[model samples]
Structures are given as structure tokens and as C-alpha cells.
Target: MKPAAILEAALYVDDLAEAERFYGQVLGLDLLAKAEGRHVFFRCGDTVLLLFDPKATEVPPEAGARLPVPPHGAHGPGHLCFSAGAAEIELWKKHLEDHNVAIEADFEWPRGGRSIYFRDPSGNSLEFAEPRIWSFT
Candidate 1:
């Protein structure tokens, strides 16, 4: 069977608290959970965004019989794209700027839609796009 959809996306960050505030307060995502010195999770629509501590998560869990899937982590910055409505594009730009977030790039897709790219506090690239930009949508 094919996988249904992406349930989660992860990015490693140097500071968990800063990431939490940026995602929760600035981006307006709901904070899901946080493990001190380990990770912070946020709810982005139906998907969960995980901000992990590279130093903590890079070390694989001890050989255990508990978890079926071992913990995995990545290094450096990661990227994530979020979907927004056509009507919300302008509002999103204003909101981001109001929060002092710099918009690195803005583009109108030839297919039909628009996207705004920016970076998180940890330097991970993040994008917001109108759903119609992608062919699958």
C-alpha cells in the first residue's frame, strides 16, 4: 500500500526555545510538545513539525525492544513548505513582516500561484505557497 500523506517533517535547530517561540508565536503554529534539551514540536495543519536538537537526536537510541522505529535525526538546516490559500498570500506577507521576519524571495509560479520563501532562526529555509502552485494540488 502506498503511504497516505506526510505526517511529520523535522528540522534540527541549535536553540529549542528560540525555535519554539518563532514557530509558535511568530508563525502562529500551535505548540504540540517540548522535551527540554531535546526537541520541540508544533502542529502545522494536519502535519507535525519537529524541531530537534541535533546533538541530542543524532545519537541513536540504545538498542531497545521498546521502539519499533529507531530515532533518526539530521544535520544542518532543513526545508519545509506550507500550503496557504490564495486569499491569504498578501496577508501572510504582511504578517511576516509585522513580526520582523524578512522575506528572502517571492515568486509567482508559471503554473498559477505564488510563494514566499524565508528562513527560520536556525537558518532552515521555509516556504509558504498557495496550493495551486504545485501540479498535484
Candidate 2:
């Protein structure tokens, strides 16, 4: 059977506090939970955005640990794109600019819709695009 929808998305960050400020303060995602020097979780409408400290997650949990989630992480910059409507994308562009976040790329897709790309403090590529870019209704 095919999986349903994505419930959460994760991104690796070196600084949890900085990440918290960016996602919570700048992007306006509601804070869900956070562990200092570890990870920060945010609510993004129907899904959750998980910002993790790679240094902490790359190592396996000690034997007999309370939560024995397997070690998982990524190195260097990763990418995450948020789905938005045409109007919302425009508003987001302005909001990001007001926050002094540089927009690295902005353009319309050859087929349709628009997308803007930017980087978080940790250098992960973040994008906002009309879902129509992929022909999603």
C-alpha cells in the first residue's frame, strides 16, 4: 500500500537556538517542542517541521536509553520546499525581505506558478512555491 501524506519534514541545523528564532520568529511557524542543543519542532499547518542538531543525532543513543530512535542525519546543506499559493508566495517574499532574509532565486516556472528560494542560517536551501508547480491541485 502507498503511504498517505507527509506528516513531518526534518532539516539539519548546527545551532538549535538560531534555528528556533528563524523558524519560530522569522517564518512564523508555531513552536511545537524543543530540546536545547538538540532539536526544535514546529507546526506547519498540516505538517511538522523538525530542525535537528546533526551533532547530537548522528550518534546512536546509548544502550538502554529511554527513546532508542536510530541515529540519522545529513551533512552539508539540504533542501526543503514549502507549498504555497500564488498570493501566499508573494506575501512570503515580502515578509522574508522585511526580515532581512535574502532571496537567492525567484522566478516563474515555464509551465506555471512561481517559486522563491532562500537559505536558512545553517545554509540549507529553503523554497516556497505554488503547489501547481508540480500540478498539485
Candidate 3:
């Protein structure tokens, strides 16, 4: 199947300290930026997971931003979900388990769908899934 639009996204956190503890310390997301209580950005490969609190600091819009910008970025539980294959999924699970990260749920959906769910310190539900492939009847 051809690629469509953005399948992944990110969210802001109420507490940067807590977010860093989970997403960085636990989940192993590389800390892209750490500006005190402002926010801590994580670089998840091509995508990004942001932990910003409005009470923190304000980042003014860049008139000539290089990357494609989001229209309405400052909002609620941004919901950044990632998709992976079987091998990658297993590896990620093992890594998270090794770090003592709690698993919210792990199940195989109807028709071969597979997924695992977990949350960061800020309590945002994060999931990694594999879509089921079905043949025509």
C-alpha cells in the first residue's frame, strides 16, 4: 500500500520533570532539548515527541521556518503513535521491559492485528502497532 499522510504525532506534557523521567529515562527517547521547566524535546527517528507546558516558556514563531510547520500545534494530548513490524515490535517491548516500563496492554487484534500499549510519566497513552494483512475471500 502506498503511503498517505502523517501516521504519527506528538503531545505536550504538564510537567517536564515527569515527562523526562518517563520518555527519556525510561523509554530511552534521546533528549533533543532540555530548557529547564520550559520543555524537553525527544527525537524519535524522523518524528518528534514534545513535552511543553504553556506556563514554561514561549517560543516565538520563526518567520522562515525550515521544516513544514503544524497549523494548530499548541493543544491537548497530541497523541503520537508509531507503527512497526513484528521484529521491531518485539525488540521495543524487550527494551521497555528491561527498563522496567509498565505495559498498559499487549494483544493481537482480530485477523492478525498486533499491538502493545504503554504510557509515559505524564500519562499519555502511547502505542506501537502492526496492521493486519488480509486476503480477499
Candidate 4:
């Protein structure tokens, strides 16, 4: 057997607060958890989006730390897409524009779904697309 599903996805940023506001306020994801200067977490449907500070995450966990997650991070922008339907894609376009977030791209996928792309404050590429872009129901 193989892995069942993705439970979490992570993106790295230099500023935790800015990332927090962008994902929490602009994108309107509910606050799940946060550790000042280290990371911020948000709930998106059944999965968790983890935004971490590169500086903090690159430093290995302290001795005796409750969770000894090893050092992990990325330098440049990463991408994450939210599942949205054709109609919801239109609503998201307006919602993001209302929040002053520019839409970098908007188009229909060749296979038969629509997608709109943008960026977060930390410059990570973001997208809202129909799950059917990958043929998901």
C-alpha cells in the first residue's frame, strides 16, 4: 500500500506576521496554530497549510523539545493551490481583487477546468482551481 492523502503542505517565508496576515486575513483561512517568529498554521478544508520562517525552521529543534522535528526549509517561493469550482473561481477572483491581491493569471485548463493564480505576501505562488483540473470530483 502507499500513502493515502496529503495531510499538510508547507511554505517558507522570511516574515511570519506578513505571511500570517496574507493567509489568515487576505485568503481568509482560519487560524489553526502559531508560534511567534517561528511559524503559522491554517486550516483549509481537511488539510493544514503550514507557513514557516526559513530562519526558524532551518534551525534544528532544541534538545528535549516536545517535538523534535528536524531542520527543514526552502529558500525561494513555493506553490500551493486551493480547490475551487468553476463558479467559486469567479467569486475568488473578485474576493482576492477586493483585498488588493492582484491576479497573476486566470484561464481555463486545457483538460477542462478553470484556475486563477496569485501570490502571497512572501511571494509564494498561489492558485484557486477546480479540483477537476486533476479530475477530482
Give the runs in model 1 whose Cα sits over 4 Å from its true position.
63-71
lDDT of 4 by residue, 1-137 (tens): 99999999999987888888888888889999999989999999999999998898889888999999999999898999999888899999999999999999999889898999999988889999998889755
Give one digit per residue, the lDDT tens place, for model 1 in 43-120. 988899989998887666767646444567777778888898777878888999999999999999988889999889
Please, what is the TM-score per model? Answer: 0.91, 0.95, 0.65, 0.95
Candidate 3 lDDT over residue span 5-121, tens digit each: 553345767877888878877667898777786668888877777677755434554788774343433545455556778787888898888877777788887778568888766
Q: How high a TM-score does candidate 3 get?
A: 0.65
Q: What value does the lDDT take at residue 65 in candidate 2? A: 98
Ranking of all candidate structures by their lDDT, best first: 2, 4, 1, 3
Distance from true position, residue 73, model 2, in Å? 0.7
After aligning candidate 3 to the native by TM-score, how far in Å is the CA of 63 from where it should be?
15
- What's the distance in Å from true for residue 4, model 3? 7.1
Instruction: Provide the lDDT at 30 for model 3.
Output: 92
By TM-score, how accurate is candidate 2? Answer: 0.95
For 20-72, candidate 2 gives per-residue lDDT tens digits of 99998999899999988889999998999999999999889999999999999
Q: Number of clashing residue pairs in every model? A: 0, 0, 1, 0
Badly placed stretches (over 4 Å) of model 4 are none
